[model samples]
Target chain A: MLILVTGGSGSGKSEYAENTAVRLAKEEDLPLYYIAAMKPCGEEGRRRVERHWRLRAGKGFETRERYVDLKGLALPKRGVVLLECLSNLTANEMFEPEGAGDRTVEGVLAGVRSLAEKTAHLVVVTNDIFSDGMTYDEVTTLYQERLGRINRELAGAFDQVTEVVCGIPIQLKVKGSSVI
Target chain B: MILVIGGAFQGKKEYVKKQFALAEEDFADGAVCGEEELYWARAVLHFHEYVRRCLETGESPEELTALTDRLIRENPDVILLCNELGSGVVPVDAFDRSWRETTGRLCCRLAGEAVRVCRVVCGIGTVIKG
Candidate 1:
């Protein structure tokens, strides 16, 4: 089961998703995994990552810093995994790595599928990109288009989709077959 | 004054029209904007485009921000429609990033003075302030 949560910057979706992951872990007594998508940078980057670390701290989660090839990573069996964010992951997968040539929508979707197959309950938190209402240069436009496509695909495959705005979670899609 | 906001093509305009009983003639498309154009309009749509246009005319975001702040303040009966741009990922280009920042600042200014603020998502309006 996968739960997709999305919102704009500072919209409080991360907090909501984190709390949801914690709750799910408690209910099922499954080991919790936090898949950190961002690579740690210098002072500024450390500060941002620290904030997220502090949020998940003491929540019984083991942090796994994985940026690409989610299926390649060795995840715990029957554990609940929360991927911190999909935006940075997408950017990393699309831009970084030697011979990263696979920036297409199919590439990201494949990774997500692999993670889903490995985890018992997956809670994925992502960002909403198209709401800005501005068409950008070719590269940025491609990034936005790919992110939008990834989001729609996740919503279609996942049992639940929620958009958080102003700290309020608006349930957008529930397939009725969801247990979490 | 009230401010209605939403993502692109999320029905913010239609919702505002139905709720306020406003017709097509009541709105002055803000893209061809001027002090004269907004003088007596019942409401304004595409105000974001207006800001973008203002930027093209060599005006700074701060200048437009001040201008819009005054416009919303003086026109108590006017209901403004704006797209909430700050909630998305920051743009990569210098120009687009500046536009996004400017629009966010302008919306913040309008939201500060407006009596009501409603966000429309999936055609559902949630009143965040009033």
Candidate 2:
């Protein structure tokens, strides 16, 4: 199953995804695999990610920080896999002028699609940047635009699409409905 | 939707807590709300932790939306405290600019979800949305 979880920052999208994945893993006895796409830039950044990981995984599950080569992870064919985010990973890997290159958004979307096709159950987390606001700068405008496109594309492919608002899950797409 | 917004280190946090306490007192005769402070701390941690996680995992927007929805569901009468990160000059670095923009977007989204929104300035609360 491919699940797409999206929301703005501080909207509780990460916690909700983590909780959902953890619950599913516990109930189904499936091995949970977390694919972290963020790169730790500094001491503060590293500590913050560690704290979130501990809070979500509770100190047991393994975590792999892979930003660029997302397709190489192989993501075990039988368990649950969570791509915590795609936008940041793409941003970090394809930084600056490179990110502005063609196929950046498409490449990320294709990666996500391939992962979903290969995995057993996948929970993909992302941000919903469209309803938030307009981007103020060039780089941000590019990122936001690309992210919005990626989100729309992934929403089309995923089995379940949920938006986390104020820490609550509003299911946007179920088995067969378009409105979430 | 009591929106409590201000810049960093402002008194919005304290004011929100007081308002929460006052509301509790008015409604339930001082019945203590256990999760107010906890939520505030969570909010503070949530901001940085979320950014860090996003940087690490490449997750999407759903995580944030789900979190906010859950919080609102749990406490409809929530007093959200948000930093006004966009009311200043744009940053020179890409990372700094993105951080500011992301936080500003999140705060705006939260205010929209709020039934009542207030901007706290100089320790005084002003309603911005209702």
Candidate 3:
């Protein structure tokens, strides 16, 4: 099964997704894996990563750092995998010298498919970044377009799509149900 | 307390007015209201701007959220209208980044305490919490 979780910053979506992944892992007796997307940087960046680490401190998740080119990576065993987010991954693929560049959408999606095939369940976290109502520079706007496309595509493919608002999960799509 | 949030011009204030039966006079515009006014107002609008103003005046994000916590405790029935600012591309300016992050953190805190929470999109209100 594939799950897609999205929300604005600090909306508690991470905690919600983490708990979901942990439950699924326990239910199926599968090893838990967490894919950390953001590359840690300066003092503030490091602090942010540390904060997330603290949140998952005892969750029994083995962390994997895949900055870009996810399709090339492989897991050691079949288990439930939680990708922390898509926003950072999109940014990395768009700007990172070694990223997929213009091929980000297909590249990331292909990577997702590959990962899903290898894991018992894949839970992907993304950002709800289109509703802020702002116009940006050309490059930033292009990034938004690309990320937006990625989110739409994944939501279509995933079994469950949820948007967390103020720590509340609003189901936008549920598998086999078109009325939600 | 009640929280009404959405993107700019999403009719959040109008929703509050119609749904809650509140008059315009009951709202304390966060853009220009005195800090003291926030504690007693029946409702508040442009809350993101209020967060920006506080940051501009040297108030740290922690201080702003703390102040809001106190406001929630003291005025438990107050209705808050805030823009959902953190859903867009991260800003290039340092201040813009801090402002959005602070506003988001504050909203999370407010939503936790609010008796009702509604998100407005395309002028339609979805009750996410109550």
- Per-candidate TM-scores read 0.65, 0.59, 0.93
Residue-level lDDT for B89 in candidate 2: 32
Order the candidate numbers by DockQ, best to worst: 3, 1, 2
- Residues A1-180 of candidate 1 have per-residue lDDT tens digits of 689999875466787898888898899898999999987777746866997889888888899998877757787577898997888888887887631345557767787788888888899999887765566788787888888889888888898899875455678887685432
Q: For each candidate, what is the lDDT?
A: 0.78, 0.63, 0.89
**Over 4 Å off, model 1:** A177-180, B1-83, B92-118, B121-124, B127-130
- DockQ, per model, reads 0.18, 0.08, 0.63
Residues B1-130, model 3: lDDT tens digits: 9999988898998899999899989999999998888899999999989999999999998899789988998888899999988777777787887788788878888998888999998899999997
lDDT of 3 by residue, A1-180 (tens): 899999987777898899999999999999999998899988778978998999999999999999998898888899999998899998899899999998988888888889989999999999977866678889888888888898888888789999887777889989887532
Candidate 3: regions farther than 4 A off: A178-180
Per-residue error for A39 in candidate 3, Å, reads 1.1
Which scores better on lDDT, 1 or 2? 1
Question: Each candidate: RMSD to true structure?
Answer: 6.9, 11.1, 1.9
Positional deviation of residue A59's Cα in model 3 after best superposition, in angstroms: 2.2
**Per-residue error (Å), model 2, residue B113:** 16
- Number of clashes found in candidate 3: 1
| lDDT score of residue A20 within candidate 2 | 73
What does the interface RMSD come to for each candidate?
4.7, 8.2, 1.4
Candidate 2: deviation at residue B54, Å? 26
